[model samples]
Target: MEVEKARVLIVGAGGVGIMAAYALEVGGKAAVTLVMRSNYRRAQDAGISIDSVDHGKGIREWRPTEIRNTIPDVSQEGIPPFDFILVTTKNIPDVPPTVADLVAPAVSPGHTAIVLSQNGLNIERPLLARFPQNPILSSVSMISTTETSPAVVVHDFADAQKIGPFVPQPAAEAAARRYVAVYNGSGRLADVVYDADVPRARWHKLVYNASFNPVAAALRMDTARMRMSRHVVDDLVRPIMLEVVAAARAAGHVLPPDLPDALIRVDPVEAAFRPSMCQDADKGNLMEIETIVGEPLREGEARGVPMPTLRTVYGILKGLQLQTKVAKGLWEPAFDDDNPYR
Candidate 1:
C-alpha cells in the first residue's frame, strides 16, 4: 500500500523544530507547520532559517511555513489538523508545561503519531496515558544542531535516527519517509536510521547526552574541551559515562565498547562546541538536568546497578541548574497547562 502524504506539525519552533521545518521546506517533504510557545514575536519577526554552525554554513531562508503555538493567543484561531506531529519540547518541561496535553486533542489517531525527538526519556509516558489510543513513536536523534532564530538553525553534526512504535502501535517495517524527507531535502542533515532497536539507540544518546551536556553546562565548556582535558574525563566524564552505561545495561541495552573513549575523541572542528544544556543555562532558561542526568541514575538503582559517577553528575548538574534558576527568580516552577496556543 502506498503511504499517504503526511501533514507535518512541528511543535516548539526552537532549534529542532525550525530545522525540521527547513528539512521539509528543502525537501518539500510534507506540508509543514511551525508552532512555538516562546519567543513567538521573534518567529513573527524572522521566519524559519536553515543554519549550521559547524563551519559557518548558517543561512536563513524563509519558506512558506505555518506558525501556530501552544499558548493561548490571538494568532491561533483556526489551524488545520496535522498528520505527523513532532514534539521537540524538553522532557523536563518548564513550569506550566501543558502544551503537550493541549496539542493532543487536535491530533486524530489516523493522522497523528507523534515522534518524540527530545533529549531525554520520561516525556512520553504522561502523554501516552492521556492519548492511550494514539501511537507515540519513541525516537532518538543523534545530530547536534544549534538554532537561535526561526530562519536559521546550525547543524553541529550528523547522526542517524532510531524510531519505533511506543504504546498501542504495531512494531513492524514502518517507513519514516515523511520524517526523513525533511532532513534530506535541505543541507540540514543526512541519513535516516530505521529497523534498529530504539531502546539501545535512545539509551546510547541518553548516555552521551548525560556525560557531555551536564558537565559542559556546569563547567561552561564544549564537548571537545571535556574530551581533551584528562582531569575532566578521568575525574568527571569517564565515571559518569560508566554509570550511564551500567544503567543502560540494566534496562536491557549495552552500548558499544570504547564508547567512553570514542565520545571523547572529538575533531578539532567540534572541540569548542557548546552543548544544548550549556546553551539553555547561559540563556537563563530551564535545563533538562533531570532527564539527561537524573533518569539514568534512578533507573540504575531500580535495576540493582551501581552508578556512583552518574549520581554525582546528577547532583552537581541539578544543583547548578537550580541555582541558576533561583538566581534568575524563575525557581518556583509550575507545570504548564495542556492548552494549545495556535
Candidate 2:
C-alpha cells in the first residue's frame, strides 16, 4: 500500500520558512503549501531561489506544491485541511495578528499539528489556550538564513533544528518525531533532533538569543564586535544570560547550571554573523522585543526573580525601537508621567 503524504502549510515566507519548505520538498515526503502574502506572485512565477554553501555554490530553485496569498485562500482553492501547520514568523505580542489568528483558518482544532519555529519564551501559551486539543510543537534552529529578496534566500551556515512537544502528550511526541524524520530524510544540510525536554531546549536557546540579539541591535554592530570586546561579553552578555537562566528556573524549567558559560563560548565563524534582531534594526523594521525579551522579564517579575540585567537590556532595546519609529514618522514623542524611562 502506498503511504499518504503529509500535507504541510507553511505560514511565513521568510528565511526560516523557505528553508523548511525546501527541506520538505527535497525530502519528497510531504506536500508543502506556502502562504506568501507579499511574495506570492514572485514565488509562483519564479519559485524560491536558494543560494547556500551547504547545498552548493550557485542559486537553486524549488517551488512548493501550492502557494497562496492567505490562509483562507488555501480552503478557497479546494485544498484540504493541513496535517501540519508551521509558523516561522516572529513572535511579537504587540503585532496586529497574533500567531493564533494567523494559523486559525488553516488548522483543525484536534486534527492538525502546529509547529512554532520562532524564537522566544512562553510562545506556546496563547496557542495552547486557543487550540486546546491540537498537538503543539516548538522548534529552535541554529541555522543562519536571510531572505535577500522576495523569492531569494541565502543560507550562511546550517545547524540542527531541535523539535519537541510543548505539551508532551504521546500524540504530540509522535507528531514531533514524524516532522523530525521528514527533515532528516532531506538531502539538505539539516540535522533535526526530537528533544524530549522541550522547555529546557527553549531555555538553552534563549540564553544565546537574549544575550546577543538585543545587544547587537542596540549597538548596531555585528556579533563579531560584541564578542570581541571582553568587557562586553564578561560584563553585559554573561549577566543577561544568567538572568535568563534564573527566569527559566523561576518559571519551573531547570536548565543546565553551566548554560551561561556554554553560551558565552561563541564560535569565531558565528561571531561575524548578524542576528535577526540586528538585521531588523539595520532595516528599520520592528523587532521581536516583547516575545524575546519582554515576556521573559515579565515571567521573572511574576516569580519574584530579580532580573536587573535583562530589564536594563530590555529598556535599551525599547528605546531603540521608539527612536526608530519616531525617525520613520510612525510615532510621535510625547511627554507622559507614567513613562518610567522618562
Top of the candidates by lDDT = 2
For candidate 1, the TM-score is: 0.81
* Per-residue accuracy of model 1 over 124-233 as CA lDDT, tens digit each: 67777776656666668766676644345667675456666554335222434345554455544545555346667767877668887888888888777766677887
- TM-score of each model, paired residue for residue: 0.81, 0.89
- Tell me the tens digit of each residue's lDDT in model 2 across 1-342: 767778899988888888888778677788888889777788888778898756654655578887878775445556677789999988777645899988887878688999999888889999999999899999888887878888888988774688999987899999999988876556554477888888778777888898888988887877677677778787788898888889889888988888777766665655577778988999888899988889888988899999998899999998888887788786788879898987
Deviation in Å, model 2, residue 214 alpha carbon: 0.9
Whole-model Cα lDDT of every candidate shown, in order: 0.67, 0.83
Inter-residue clash pairs, candidate 2: none
